[model samples]
Target: MPQPRSTRIAVIGDIHNHWNAQDHLALKSLNADLALFVGDFGNEAVEVVRQISTLDLPIATTFGNHDAWYTATPWGRKRCPYDRDKEDWVKQQMALLDHADTGYRHQDFDTVSVVGGRPFSWGGPEWRFTDFYGEWFGVHNFEESAQRIQEAANAAAHDTLIFLGHNGPTGLGKEPEDTCGKDWRPIGGDYGDPDLAAAIAAVKASGKSVPLVAFGHMHHSLRHTKEVQRTRLCIENGTVYLNAACVPRIMDTEIGTQRNFSVVTLQENQVTEVNLVWVDEGLAIASTECLYTTMKVTEHSASV
Candidate 1:
């Protein structure tokens, strides 16, 4: 008898305290062998886990800038170098983390793996530079993060997948443009690390395609952009990068608006399709396209 083939993985990005919404969608539409969350589950992290626990699939997650658990230590001290308002919101978040830990220990939830392959993974929640700007910005050292990703790739079989940090591989997906020609640069663009970019390049160069890399951090655009320079590198080496940020206001707002998440489908070691599903006026909007063919990844990729 042969081992059962891995089920298609569902990659979700940036659920900021929208646990109820995510739970509804997951119950209604999410069908994968594994569910991968790219980060930013917010204060409802444990609730999210509780909802996910109801499913039979394995749940893998990384920390976004807003995870909150990483900011406060076990003894209620600030582990990260940054400051946070632990009033109502912090207390709530810490409670959720405590619940999540208890659930894990009791075998009521799935395992939460970080970058370094440790019981908790590499890089502190404070290492991310992007978290410094109101939102969860800077956390984790990109170089070390990249190394861990590479190690995971090397160790896993052909079917193993990876969930990247909020900051994606540089040049792996589309780069958001100054569509309005305005000079309002987002916080991520300013604090984005070049070292992480190089590390991503090295991973692709290693010749083991990561299959799927999901991320958030950018909340404006829901579409994939061809502006990613590292994507070219991945194509040359063989990997697919998906930007799964689900911001619903990108289409309606002028400055920065668009809300959607990437529903990525993978089968037979290739990305079959990517759907940018947007939520508009309490309804779901979607745009589907083939990203990679049986032979090669598409060259005429779309931008956000």
Candidate 2:
């Protein structure tokens, strides 16, 4: 028997406790083969868990900043890590899904494999620079985290691989509107994680056919602007990076009207189409584009 060549994956962005019955219903209606969540369930972790429970599909997820707090152990003043459970609550809650953090785990569906992990760069309720330099609260380590991603990508047995990270890898753009883009009006620079970026580059350079890399954390647009559809997707270096962080810093305002969710299609080890869907208002496609062709770029590529 030949393996399945095409797969439809419904990628859900940062719920952050803002997801309503409409959002939940929209997810269930997608009828996708796999449900991939980009983390950030937020303060309503329990309620969010209950909501996703109804999806009734093969699910895979990575931990987000908000999710860390909900799943962490009450040890330090800020629930760092030296003494904590580390999203064990969520793991127990979503026992039926493949959850990866600090390392990578793959879910096989015959022809394709989805390799995902909660890149250990900037996560947890509060992220400090020291967290990546050394070890914050005893869990987050940049070097180790990047190394794990490389190892997992190397060990995978599938030819087609899809990478998932909470906050995407850096180097996509230096602008404040890029994947990890930061406003440089006063102070300029890219806000993405260097370790995550390096790891992603290494995995890609390894000659692995990783066509899709999905992530969340950095939002699309904070202030209301015509660029609402700007940061939702980025196609660079033969890889498609999707920023599924639908909720902006200002919540409840753009929930139903923005492109918060996505349905990504992969065919024959390549990304064929990306449908950025909006669910907060009425379930609809905010943008749909075909992306099977690869475009090469210097260390950094153009983010669509």
Candidate 3:
């Protein structure tokens, strides 16, 4: 039997513990084949991960830097909101996810495979948490990190791949408002993961068709200027890179409470549509803003 050629993917960006029963219900109503999560599910939030674990759809997730926020550094540990010694929040969250955690790994579907970039990455040129990486992944440096990601891509059973990461790969843009650009002071520099970029090159060199790369660390709202939002979509080298970090994914509006989800449609092994959608409490699509299409970037794509 021939497999279906089209897949609708719903990306629930950096949760930061915003997930609830309503979001879960909204996801079920969307009719998406797969749900992608870019982590930051709230400082190693075990409860949030537990809720995510019960979702009834296929999923691929990569842990964000915030997943390891409290465990990565001495300062963070000192300020941990939860008791570290009594309960390992990170371990519990990972355990809840099981195979859903795709960092340095790949999850295969019928037609396409979702491969992961580095997990728990702060997304920059610098390597911040060596000890944490060494203990968990045995990856000591950027080279090893690149190798791990590339190896995962190479192991994919399918040629059509979607690379998911906590943060995007480098070289998309250098401006603070770029998808993965650094927005803090000394702002004008790439804040994407270099290892992920290396892995992408390797994957392409090995002849895999990379349709899309999705991540969420840099929020869409710009810290530099409220006049403009971050670049949420970038198309280059036969790939579509997206920043799905729609902060406060749950927002209260005049109409009612709206939940956001970045939806990407893959057809014939190509990204055909990308949109930032908002769903009302009734699970109805309240708003739809098209960000990308096979033909052209729609008017809705303008700094939205």
Candidate 4:
């Protein structure tokens, strides 16, 4: 367990099957006390989830829209890649995590706790996929879904909570490049989950200290243009909302192919620093980009 003064956490953004053994090694090299995964292992990517299960560390995760790609819609159900899917792939992934899935639930760690929003979400103002949430989460509408999320927060063991989700909550922004904004064609609208938004508001109103809300579905690389990258960090009411989806997390740098992971550190139950560190082939930090910070890392307590 990490000390209260300092807790180091590694945040994995949307993994659209861009994970492998190297990622595990990279994460280990960082020595994060806890790992928070924001979901999207792949399109019902059982093999990918299996790979993640073998990791030896404390983890809290949820499903992304891609995690149920094949089964979420009629189009996908018809052509599920896994012929051996004798069981639901989503369940398979959930079991693979040892039930560490935090969607509409809470995972308590040493100091801070993780409360999840809706899992397997495709963010938007309108709800399109109904059967998926109904069957898996037993949530049919935003009201019920919001209640579940709030219940998780209400049950949290710690005052400082980290809300993890596949897509970010609403009220961040509606611009195309905003954290959870819609970047596709008619580019400009809040692509955040309404239920998640409501739950977050309710949780904050209940007087809990929400340090961060991290997720990754909106890729950093935008579809509209390359002139500007998507805004990945938002600070509102003392909570930091981050989008860790640096797509193609495995990329070829000038030195070699590097793996990316968001390194976040909290001190005194408040976020202090965040960085997107690129680990090289040798499993050493090759480069780093400071995403957000309030003080020097050394100012915090011992980073477990």
Error (Å) of candidate 3 at residue 61 is: 0.8
Scored against the true structure, residue 67 in model 3 reaches a CA lDDT of 87
Name model 1 segments beyond 4 Å from true. Answer: 1-7, 21-28, 43-46, 69-142, 157-163, 172-175, 178-183, 186-196, 222-237, 249-261, 278-304
The parts of candidate 4 lying over 4 Å away from their true place are: 1-4, 83-85, 295-304
For model 4, how does the per-residue alpha-carbon lDDT over 1-304 read when each residue is reduced to its tens digit?
A: 8656789999998888888888898999999999999998988888999988888999999889998888788898888777644677877888888557898899999898999999889888887688878887788899999999999999989988999999998888888978888999898999999999899988889899998889999998999989988887878877888889999888887778988899998899888888988899898899888877785332211121
Q: Highest lDDT, which number? A: 3
lDDT per residue as tens, model 1, 1-304: 8753434555666676655544445324545555556556653255664554455455555555555554433423344433445344444443444422211111121222222121121122234333322232223454544454455544444423343555454443323332111113441232233444454456556664445555555544423443432221123244555555554313554433334445566655555565555544344443444445445446534332
| Candidate 1 TM-score to native | 0.56
Kindly list the per-residue Cα lDDT of model 2 for residues 2-26, writing each as its tens digit.
8757788888777777666666666
User: After superposition on all CA atoms, what RMSD does each candidate show versus the true structure?
Assistant: 8.8, 5.9, 2.3, 4.4
My TM-score estimates for the predictions, one after another, are 0.56, 0.73, 0.96, 0.93
Give a tens-digit lDDT track for model 3, residues 181-246: 899898889999999999998899888999999999999988878898888998887698989999
State candidate 2's TM-score.
0.73
TM-score of 4: 0.93
Q: Kindly indicate the candidate among 1 and 4 with the higher TM-score.
A: 4
Clashing pairs in 3: none
- Candidate ordering by TM-score (highest first): 3, 4, 2, 1
What value of lDDT does candidate 1 attain over all alpha carbons? Answer: 0.43
Model 4 worst lDDT run, 10 consecutive residues: 295-304
